[model samples]
Target: MLPFTYALRNLFRDPSRLAQTVGGAALVVLLMVSAAALNHGMTQVLSASGSPNNVIIMGAGSEESIERSEVHLEAEAAAATGIDNTATILGTPAVSGEITYQAPIRTESGKEEPALLRGVLPKALLVHTTVRLLEGTFPNSGEVMVGKLAHRKLGIPENEIAVGKTLYFGNVAHKISGTFSAPGTVLESEIWFDRNDLSTLTQRDTLSAIYARLDNPEDFDNAHVFTLLRNDLELSALREDDYYSKLESFYAPIKIMIWLTVSLVAAGAIFGGLNTLYAAFGSRTREMATLQSIGYTRKALLVSLLQESLLATMSGTLIALLIASLFLEGITVPFSVGTFTLTLSPSVLITGLTTGLLLGTLGALPPAIRTLAPKLNKALRS
Candidate 1:
């Protein structure tokens, strides 16, 4: 058997080949890591945005989009009174009748971009338990509260939307009174306004939806039954967690596109790396043949070659991980609905390490076999 040092020493024999192998592996592994992280972040944010103990009541026909739903103001009173097992804080019922709008708003720099807006009353806090006021106060008649990541969605610098700044909704300006956070949820990318203020500004007479929190998740059927019995209200009830799960399904095509793009690019890099390995191994045929003559088995030579390949690929994997930590971690990406932060979660790390191992083992097999294929005499002559 070839000593471990033999494979280690051979790597330094050609500086250019060593660099190519390592660089190619790094590029391929980095692309895979990026894809995994992006998809995981998007899914994670959506899943965390909903609570099992809450139920959403939207207009019957607009179940897919809350922004387009229109519910009569009277439905709020009906839901609070009719829904059984409703959760409460002190004596107030955990119900929030709100409006959701998407429109362009001008920043302090006069730059305009479309942003999500939610209109809510103080009771909104009861239904959305994840939200926390990080600074300042809740929006009042002439004020608005910004989410911690709203700037990313608005395509502006963080200072542009900081507290004390003003944002223009058409000709009227509203003070940025506060900033709030809903960690790992889509709510962090929205601008929240007082319910009455948004109603007058948007000229909306109807509520977009009503959110109600139940004492137990199993009580969901009671809420669903309430909607059925009050057919005159034209309302539909759905568990909040199920609503977000449906949104995740709606974005399936976008995730598929991301994977397709990564696979195409990685294929090109893999083939390029394979060609380099074939050339590097081809040139060492005579040396391998000499080792066989010295009583070293062909299987031993193959293992040594694989060891050399694994070392280079693993080094490249480390480099890729370092780069990801420095640049990709905590970076926010905005989509149509909200913004999500990239994270190197356990699943993403496992994906990257597995990709590196596959490339090192399977990617090296073809060239290693071809190099040792010829008879000893023929290989020596070459």
Candidate 2:
């Protein structure tokens, strides 16, 4: 077996190659790890949206956006009756019924982007614990509420956002009022309005979907069948946590892409790693020959080369993870998983480290074996 120091030193023997190999591997690992984190972040946002006791009621087929679900007022009324008044935030009713939809709004600065719009009673603030007025006041009629994202993507202002800023939709103009946050939620993607106001703009005169809060998640066991029973309802109920989980599933393609990209880049990285180790050994064959002549076992030589490869790749992995942690912290890219605020989770960190080690072994073995396999008899005369 190689001395640990000996393996470590070999990687730096050629400073230029070490830099090239480590830097390239760092870039590949950084991207792969970050992408994995983003994918996990999406899942986290959705998962965090609800506790065990809360539930959501939406149109039968409306998966990603509750905006697309259109339920009648009576169906909403029945669900509202089922609220577990006990768990309500601040002693209010547990259920904060809301109407959710979307509208097109132009920014004060950037290009036009559609803002997700929601309508809720004042108690929605009290009911959804995660929601609060980050600044300004709650919305009023002809007034609008904006998400942090709405301001960023559409360049709208929330503080200076007026009570009468008109958001022009299809043929209607809705007013802006105040700002609030249901951060890390589907609500962050939306603008709030009076449900009646939404009905006026879209002319549906009914809610798209109704969201409910419950005291315990178990309250939902029979609720789905109940919601589905009304022939006229065409609505389904789910635990708020579960409802968001379903939404995260919509982003499965993004996760797949992350794996696909990392797999491809890491494949190239494996080659680069192999090439680096190959060169390290190729330049030292004379030394190897001498060692063989001195009675060192070929098996030990093989182990040494493999050890060196592991050292270089593991070093590269640690560097990648450190850089990822320090640089990528608290960064939230706007993505919608129902209402989740997707951010990297600890699980993703572990995944990156595991990949690095695996890449090290797979990347190192081939070249190590090739370099250590030569004959003892041919070289003495040469």
Candidate 3:
């Protein structure tokens, strides 16, 4: 068997070609890692913040968004019985009925953005403990609460844009009051206001969703049935996890768009890396031939070439992962995980690493084999 040095030296024997191969693979890996991180960030938003015990009651036929649904008040009242007050320590129903809307908003810096706003009752906070006021107090009637995301996007300090000041959604200016951050879920991207205030401002007559906590985490279906059988409200009960799954399906197009972009971009890099490996192997044809010309077998040379490709691919993977870990540090996308920070978990890192490994193998093997074939003998004889 030849020394490992032999394989390493052959790869960089042509500096320019080596750069081309490694650099191409690096670009491909970088794209995939970043896209994967972003997609995971989104998936993590709901999965991380979602709870098995929590249930979201939305108007039937609302699909993934509550913005489209309008529930009747009496139906909502009837569904309240599903709550086990004994299960709620506070002697109140562990439920929150609220409204969610999408509004075009801008920062104090004059940058316009669109975000979803949730107008929820105080009980909603009790129901969803993941939500907490990280900075200021909760919004009161005629007042509003903004999330940390709104802080950045709106270019305002944490709930410090001068309380009593007004933010316009459409034509009405809702008074600024407090701020809150919900853990891991997409709620951080949301701004909240008093349901009563929102109703008065929009002149809306009904709530969009009713969220509740169950006595048993496993009773999601039981609670769901309790809500579903109500004769009054046109309610649809969904376990939070199941609800988000539907939401993910609803947003499948967006995820597909990201995947498509990554695929198209990565394809070029894959091809470039493949060519680099082929050329690198071709340049080493005589050396590989020399090895085989001596006591070394063709299989050993092939193994060496495979090792080189794998090493290069591994290096690119490490590089991409480093960038993802450091740069993607605290990216809070407009989604939620339970009441926690949407972090880059071990799973995401594993996925990126796996992707890198595949990139190395797929990009390097075929060309390496073709070059290390008996054709090396012909080249050496030349």
Candidate 4:
């Protein structure tokens, strides 16, 4: 077999070609990282938004969207019976009546955007234990509390959404009374107000959903059974975690579309890479023939060629990871409901590297095989 030095030196034999191949591989890897990061960010956000011990009872036919659901205020009163082993705070059952609305909000710059506005009774604080007030006090009538990511979702500057700032939602000017955070939860992208006040303003008397915390996470069956018995309310009960899992399915198509785009572009890159490999290996036909004549087997020569290709591609993979860390990681992607920060976590990094290695191996093999196909005499002569 030839010395490993031969394969290593061959990688840099043509500096310009090496750079081009590495750059192309880096681009393809970057595309892969982008797709994986996007999917990861979105799916993680949804999956993290729910708690296993929480239960949601929303109007039937509106399981996918709380804003479209309507549960009577009476449902909140019956929450304790609806869920077995309901959690309690200060001797009161942890239950909340909530109303959700998408309202047009005017930013400080006078630009208006739609923001998800959730109206909740005080008990919501106990039921949604993930939420914590970051500053100031909860909202009163004619006042509102903004979530940490609400400004980004609304396309407003951070200063404009701070406590004491005034934001116009519809014709009513609601003062920003506080800021709240529920890290890794969708609630961090909504505005909160008093339940009665929002109902008055939105002209909706019905609550959107009833939320309750249960002592045992497995008590969801009791909630479901309760919902079935209350035929008058036409409500459906779901475990909060299970409900959020459904959101992943709801966005399944978007994930598919992202990968579809990457597949198309990567296919072009793979073909271009294959052509490059063919030309590069084809140029070394006589050299490989000489090695074969020196008692080196075809398999050994193939390993040498692969080592060279992998070295270039792996370098590109490292470069792609660095680029992703600097630019793509933690990028905020806003959607209709909220925003999620793109993360280049370990799994995502591994995926990018795996793709690069596969590309290098597959791209080089066919051309390398074809180059070694000719008779030893003919290859040496060529």
The candidate maximizing lDDT is 1
| lDDT by residue (tens digit), candidate 3, 1-382 | 6688877876677777766666666677777766766777676665755677788888877747678888776655565665443147457777778888776765444545566778877777877778887655688776677765665444455444445556776655667776566666667667788888777766899988877787777777666676567746667777877777776676678878988998998887887777767766777677777877678877787777777777777777777767766777675444322122334577767766777788776766787677677565596974
Worst 10 residues of 2 by lDDT: 335-344
lDDT of each: 0.95, 0.66, 0.70, 0.89
Candidate 2 lDDT for residue 102: 53
User: Which residue pairs does candidate 1 place in steric collision?
Assistant: none
Each model's total of backbone clashes? 0, 15, 17, 0
- What lDDT score is found at residue 55 in candidate 4? 92
Where model 1 places Cα greater than 4 Å from the true spot, the runs are none
Q: What is the lDDT, from 0 to 100, of the residue 113 in candidate 3? A: 59
Off by over 4 Å in 3: 81-86, 106-110, 152-166, 220-229, 335-344, 375-377
TM-score of 2: 0.84
Pitting candidate 1 against candidate 3, the one with the higher lDDT is 1
User: Which of 3 and 4 is ahead in lDDT?
Assistant: 4
Tens-digit lDDT string for candidate 4 (125-215): 9988889999999898888999999988988678989999988876788899999999988889999988888999899889999888888
Query: Which 10-residue window in model 1 sums to the lowest lDDT?
Result: 313-322
